[model samples]
Target: MDKKTIATALAMIPILGVNAGADSIETVSNPAPIQRASVKKTVTADVLNVRSGPGTTYSSIGKLYMGNVVEVISESGGWAKINYSGKTGYVSTDYLKSNESSSGGETSKPSGNQKSIQQVTSSILRVRSGAGITYSKVDTLHKGDNVTVESTENGWAKISYSGKSGYVSAVYLKFVEYVDEDSSGGSESSVIRGATVQRSSKSYSLDEMVEVQYIKAQNGGNLISRNNARTGEEVFTTYIIRNAEPRAYGKPTKDELRYYLDPANFEGYSSGLMQFVRLDRYTNTITADSLNKYFASKGTDCVFNGKGQAFIDAAKKYNIDVLYFVSHAMWETGNGKSALAKGQVVTSVDGVTLDKPVTVYNFFGIGAVDGNALEAGKLTAYKNGWTTIEKGIDGAAKWISDGYIHNSKYNQNTVYAMRWNYEYSWHQYATDVNWANGIATMMSSLMEKYGTGEGLLIDIPDYK
Candidate 1:
């Protein structure tokens, strides 16, 4: 039997653009109402986008491109019900070739009881907090963390991170290493220069060593931790599409790594993802007290002390959840969108000249976003404020309404409705998952990788 498509707009309650339409103009005053009852599907697609509405022309919300590997909600006509920039929207299903029989199409509203299984990568790698370079160590590992390789984006590998959304550099991490060896030896054990080799009491049988290499025996031996060699920018191919001439991305790649990795780039900055970030917003936090402190630490960027203090203050204000804020900053600002993608993606070409146009800085993912919000509050996402990161993300799950639910949406489940706009065409269905999941993905990845977390799940910085 065909599911009945009811008109929710008549009720005055919203449902991800699912509300009553073509009814009475008097009923059209509310903001994007949220929720749903059923979902369309639960299959991954080649490319998907969560859009602003059920039809194209609304706007691009997020990109979910990856061949037929990207999972998504079921189908509505030829369109896939998608999450449009933290709201409920739909995208064309023409791009996806893979199909799975799951639920009705409801992108954000999920009513079923589903257990989450993490996606772990093949190799063991370093996990950090705060999405950018200055990651505070959370935990170290030896692979098989989450137990499965759920997804990949650009160069960022998404394993359970620790059950949240942990990420590692795919280029340096070694997803899978295939090597040809000379026979004759079963298993050989060698130590790094100046290191000693140890043997374990859980003795391995001859059958255990495939190509036996000589083993070393120590009194009461123990395995040693390796040094960090996977440092520096990884040169992996990401469809992220960077700009060369005229404009840039997030931050000039150089500035991005420098600011986040080096405490100095933050010399004159303030606290909170918003205030301390954008170059124009620099004056707010760059006080004399800030500068002198940096001069005492690292010593090199002593000249930049005052500038970086804002970050410290912001960290204090938000407490532990501060890391969650970092997720959006690093991704959008590329550490500091001021230098990298500032011009390239934040300009007039995209339609909305973002105030601080960078890849991740598109807070609220306001593709073609220009200027800050007309209002200044938690609700307003304009300007270089956490509001950009906060609302676009925190409100992600319930972004839609109750009138249009299909009962099968989970962060793990993919849907491609962000591609409803011409801007997101290359990323049809969803341009990328990094986008679709929003800030929730940030916290999820952080804790997953680090194995540590604190504070609120959706705590955004205060808006002024």
Candidate 2:
């Protein structure tokens, strides 16, 4: 039950060493015909120099650090010509190692079919002048922004922004295809091509959502105890409901809270959009093979394995989203490793003595509160006669459908609704601010592994 604090920090931008201007750098005269396919080379030296020409006689224009990957244009006489920050420069071939073999004689061009569209995944992505962090930043891109990727070298993606060519870390970019807005089937503005918004009576801006859901709830004399007194940077305490350990909680910084609360951050990626997906929608795409494959991918080796048919049947019987049901169960049970997931023998429940020591299973952590999660969960399972894995799955699905998905009071049929509960904010499923986001992420991950976007419906909240 120990309270944990989490902090967010910004990265320090490195200062580039630029002694000479681009105009002063000597260009390769009558350069040999470009040969070999487009190849990436990693810098082997701690600090390699980019010279105006091929030899030591050339002036040093810039410096490249170890692990920096550069696109090699051509190589001759132990010197390699490279594309340095949109300009041509030469570096010692000895200090550069080719990432792949160069066998093809065709020359590589930044134009034509090499181009692809990519969406930014990071909250704030820096566009550097070169392919490495040491290079000067040319621009900044936010989450959900789209950029045309000309090429990818090492771990950097080459993009053209603001009439200039720049490089962004490939790790922050995701390949995305454009979807026509008209095809979205809604009037609400679609944040991403595949996601559509839905108008609601109650809506809150990103800042307002964070304030009401996290800041106000935590600071407004709530009963939950904190590890430390509230500070300017640290604003909220969130319980960790997904873990098997007891009393796991976290105090997230302001920036962390805003990142999770921002709908734009999640809407940009297909998986992130799961928060707003209606969990009651029925689909035939989900199958036992797919569910079992998802479990296999997570390396889950418990009773939940081979029970995919039970989950599918429960979802069909209760009109629940099978993917969401599986994801929720996996999250609650720590991928089916928790004691409740494994089942526990009980002789008594809620002060009611039982006739015998009956074993019960709680797959979705129903009735598992913060303090007494195990006992409460077991009692609910025992009462429902969830002595078998199939029973646990079916019973938990019914509980979720009746209590949250189809509940008249809250009407929380989606992850976002389950967490925020705009109709009844106090009736949310969990105290953890990240509870909905975590489940949505898991759902997204499972979909990416085995599901497709065909017939996918996204519901974005239209904030006032």
Candidate 3:
């Protein structure tokens, strides 16, 4: 959608000449009592100037890019006033038009049972008094904690925890199916009746390992080969189409990921099967405080202290999932203790020698690898950024945001989806079959540990 005011009579000087003024000036007199309904307009220009006043004489304070929607406040001769970036500004009336877009053409909202069971997948999930992060922490729950779901709203689950009902992030809760342990086997796995079953043990038997390996080999090749395939031929392929001069790829927001992954509702899928993840799959609610607190809980000094704010900043700036990004970082850095997290030497870039020796302060270990097979990947990331902590976080965030989480090309949002090699048969993020699942586990653990209570920030800072 685009928005702007009706152009002044003189705005047509180039097309209509000086004579176009007096008699040809188009006027939009202020509507009496104004339109009762708020007017939402789309910007039609590539870059429409946002002037401080309703005339061309007004100074340009900012810009309203094409497709940007703004509410029309009032109008003068040929100018429309609007609230731009929190301040009143005027855009040429010529570029503004009523928004005609639908809700992405969805015919109905997502449907689910009114009340259902969900398990806390986090190691320690904080129960808040309300739905938003600003709410006070009233209680806490642990990994494998079973709670009765009373209701859910806006990424939060209202549950009956510890004899009291409170709200927790729905992202950390997994839908489960409750079941009793069978007497045939001396083992018991908690089945919550409706949730996806949690894998009982991290370790597998020899037969199980062999079977997994066979499956992987059939799917691709060696485990290391799969791990090295993240930057495969598909990395060079373009997916998202941007509108800017450089025409870079665009990333998906959480909502967009949800829409694309939900095959039941959206029609843009090449495969109708919802192979990405479980129904409850989502990005955890992570913050800077969450990272710092998780680091402190480990009792080891980490470079991530005072760095949570940076992650939070980058997450918002890039529209990436804060929890997923931080969880992946923590997993790669061992809670910020890894040498790669501190900084590493980047000997070259795209196999070219740098003018001077360059070091990368990578947090997520994007291109870094231990073996000779993946050295070039590290250099590829260095050229993109990762030289410093902030650059590393932002660069890696953008990469993940555009590639794994919400790439227009692949559109794989879930970790399981990342392992899926649908289009390029060789594309996968890790060698081990459990890589995506392991990251999910780490995300839950981190959120349980630092996502709630005193560790949770009541007032998350808005960097934007």
Candidate 4:
């Protein structure tokens, strides 16, 4: 048969095994009062089938992958009724494991040293799949919402919300006394402080920042190579420089740049507001173990691995925030997988010749400029005697500290200031509009994972 005719016949063939009339299988209904205690579970199987009913006889409607978190509203026999993709579905309880306890029963109330209950104080708080902001958000909790505090770890409070066990920032949760059914008692107040915001003297409208970016784009800015002059004036373009030749940059629209530049766009999210945090401040809370964990989380396997102490030492020496310093290095070096980070042997660059070949490492892309990033970056590393990974890290930290964080003229200590330098528009760190945002996100992720949100000073620019 011809290809088209054969394809048509194949399409007409009915799917084999699955019963066509299986739609009549029992739909999910409200669970009985006794079975209504919601429990959070993680899928243990590589792939578990979600069905219309509780057994293999029922047809498969969807699938759940391993490590996927789901809320088990109820259980019967060996099947779990879970809220899957906005609809109810059933999966074998054998393939699921509870996040809190192995028993398929009501979540146990806190006892002993564990606090009984806590109230959400933030206008809106996100319940993450894991303890850190790097994890996906599972749900949200609103102000005044009371939740049973199962545990607290790494500045996150483990709680069951909307049938799902997830973590919310402990900073926004206040302790509330739990009263038994027979007893009546008043609740005590113990509110943990969240991020503190301070207004800066410098101010600029969103339009002014966008205009400054456009001006920089046209005048040989740090990373910007060309502009879409014919298309429109507001739109700017740059190149994404990998190890190879520079590739065409994405044309970010003026609106997109505005969104990235506007401080108000980040005010709603506690972590997002971290972009305005002063990077010059040093904290003793950061440890080598925490930095190692952060590096491992990013899947960094290069020479930068196990160099956490070097990063901490550099941060302390430069009086820079360890989180910012490490995150900036991770971003610049592609989580320590970039060519410059891995080290490159060089004897010469830009018509300049050296006496001997030296293997140089650049953990922070220090001298990486547009057009010739790789060569220039390696040369800069060699000149600075960054022959070792630790030396490279310390050297980069010193450079950044002197040039931007502690610079007398620029004083661009925060990510916001680095991007939108109100004092000197041309002295901004990067030409890429997303540079500050990306670094800030990394900083926030690290902070969320390891920081306790105590004594955080956020300097938000007050735009006129």
Candidate 5:
């Protein structure tokens, strides 16, 4: 309270104060903050609506885009006051991004948001009693079984099933909220609906069993199945059929190979999947209730293991291939190149950058990354650069839903990233099976290496 002391306190206010979303308090006036400077939280949402007052019912001001930075001015139980666009507003802290825009710049935290979700990841999935690892079996849920979602408990989705609340492991359900890519090109594509994909019995080669997938434009890519031709049963309320694989007549020169290898350069490497990951891992803008949707059985799942089992469980709930998801994670964290990755420095294949050369994570090439944590290093305008792998997955999901990756798919020659990159590996990569072939090939390879390859999961090739 002395004049000098008052002046010192005033100086500290600018750094200490913040405008955070709902469910959170921005400043700690009595105890003071560990560090000063209000952190600018973001709307991890692709389209976060800015509201007046402190609730969603408040009049809408404007919409916040993904990574829209805001000043955290104040906080409440689970809310934070922040500047959305040019206006001051409150948002739910449940969705408020906890990780600083900078990785390694500060210690991070998270929460539990499970048990309140009911998804159909795999058809004929089983539901259990209570949300426990040792819970008893309740019944089986076929693909497209829409059960009521409940609160997150013990890492399982507590769904209200058949007049009773039962627990369903997130692994069995893939939330149908899909990211709609703008595949404008008159290219071939297929949409698989079930949790598992089945190849017809007769066919053995890559293109044989693809009959399950419906090929759209004869651009590129093809399907493979066990049988040559068989029943057209619907998996998850959809049908998958095969088509001709695009032919990669000419080989790309060494120069073309080098271009796609670079994250900033390769069309898909940078914009396609990377964009989607950014959206998927993004935080903020969703209701606190929605936050529980991301949590697992226990707090330990989140606070440890690189956000491991919890993240795995969450992805399973969404029915995304962890390998594909993790690849993007390694891309962002630099495969440990980032200090965030335990001081492991991921390098380029040519020993240059982390994203390029080879994007690898986990035992079977998994995970994604943003860039670098906070100030470690950054990808120029990209936030969450040098950050954790999950953030990359968040970004990719967002990008895919935003139609960022599919923008260039309209024309035959337009280059695509992950959706239909003929450069990677696939038959008819350019001709008959353009986009469809590339995605199907990946799925085909996955089955060859991992599972039995029977189910509706691989039905929808990422192309068409």
Candidate 6:
């Protein structure tokens, strides 16, 4: 595979990937009511503040603009306790006018586009497998999530998300005017809203192969067995270097290699690699506090606090090497400082050149410029629960685990084999001859700081 074929294109676009699963909430809110009983009420105010309680002192959780519709649960002292999204909140009774036409009764039948788009009013709403709360949650949509309504049944709205249909309570649904932001076959947002349909099977290209392996690893299908410890460690080492080489240069020249291998820097890189070796055995044990502190030390402005939890979850869920995964993300994202890491870039699979760009929160730079980047981005969109940090971390971990560690096809499980198996393997992950050494240097650096261990005692022969 021509690695640069896709990477070069991605380089042309702005890099903007931010971690969106961090702790941004001031308080954790509860899910909305499940019982299907309520009276219709419309918000008459231009903007009505939804509070946590039925008083002036209650914290405002969200806002509903004029013409917004909601289900009134009960009446209070000039306040209406309403069901918005999946959460219960209070609004001023004066601003809520009772709809006698549909009060405690079925809504009038929908006509045309009025039934097509529904505005999500809840702060956080779950898209379920079935209509009721008993049905498992397939995904969650935020306050402003776009829903292309397909149909409704018994106060449950069936809407499309990333090409998949799921149910949301109709009580929190509001009919909004249709806005044609992009008439050119919908926007990247539209595609991401329902992007999970299985692609047709074909001869897998390099990117496609990465995608397959990533998904498989995520599903816990492709995992390194304990019996394969020796081979797994070797493959893991190779991946570290493959990732490290991209940091110095696409293909480092002799001087560039020397600059990277200077005794001072080499030791740091080696420490980085050794940390991976130690943490691979630790599995998914990273704590949220530890991760948050690390990010804070690095000055990374993470959007969500659950990111650390997300990494730990992915590591535990997929059996991926935690230290190596975290370090690789730090390297790629500049400790989450890069534009792509910060979630600033927005474009379609074609990147910034497209007519309509899709917001991508890919931390590991997956599918950035490649056609697969868009698909990867959509799969990791917030709606799918693979927010930027989770997407980047999990996607990269799965790719490394499936592509190198315990690779069934190439059998180049060792770093030495991956670097020198030119005659046997069709493609080498990194072309630089000192790729392994470079990663070993990074491993040394990481270990020197955050961990304690003997560095990788590897010998390197310099080429002049």
Q: Tens digit of lDDT per residue, candidate 4, span 155-215?
A: 4667763234788766566555433432211121112134444444334676887777666
Show where candidate 1 strays beyond 4 Å. 1-47, 67-77, 83-86, 97-159, 162-464
Better of 5 and 6 by lDDT: 6
List the RMSD of every prediction in angstroms.
23.8, 24.5, 18.3, 24.2, 22.4, 27.3
Give residue 77's lDDT in candidate 1 (0 to 100).
45
Per-candidate Cα lDDT values, in order, are: 0.30, 0.66, 0.52, 0.67, 0.36, 0.50
Higher-TM-score candidate among 2 and 3?
Answer: 2
* Clash count per candidate: 118, 0, 24, 0, 144, 43
- Model 3, span 7-109: residue lDDT tens: 5544644443333445554434433433344466656675688888867777987665544456677776668877653456788889986654365632211
- Per-model TM-score, in order, reads 0.21, 0.52, 0.39, 0.51, 0.23, 0.34
Model 1 whole-model lDDT (C-alpha atoms): 0.30
Q: How much lDDT does candidate 4 score? A: 0.67
Tens-place lDDT digits, model 6, residues 1-464: 48887898867665544435654432233334344457776666767889999766899987776555677887755777887666888889899775554465545332322334555666557889997899999876544344666655444677764345788886566554433322111123211121111111122333433343334334432232122222222333332333343232233333443343233343233332232132222332345666666666655364333477776666665554454556556655555655555664444433435576445465666544445544554544433334455665666666665665435454333343344332333445444444444344444444344443421112222122
Error of 3 at 51 (Å): 40
lDDT digits (tens) for residues 112-176 of candidate 1: 31212222222335655533346565544332222123333333444442134454543223222
- Ten contiguous residues with the weakest lDDT in model 2: 231-240
Give Cα distance to truth, residue 434, candidate 5, Å: 6.5
The all-Cα superposition gives candidate 5 an RMSD in Å to the true structure of 22.4
Better of 2 and 3 by lDDT: 2
Q: After superposition, how far is residue 265 of candidate 5 from its true place, in Å?
A: 30
Instruction: Give the lDDT of residue 351 in candidate 1.
Output: 51
Better of 3 and 5 by lDDT: 3
lDDT by residue (tens digit), candidate 5, 110-221: 2322222223534345677766557689765544344455433223556654344576654344332212132110111122211222111111322322322223222223
Ten contiguous residues with the weakest lDDT in model 6: 192-201
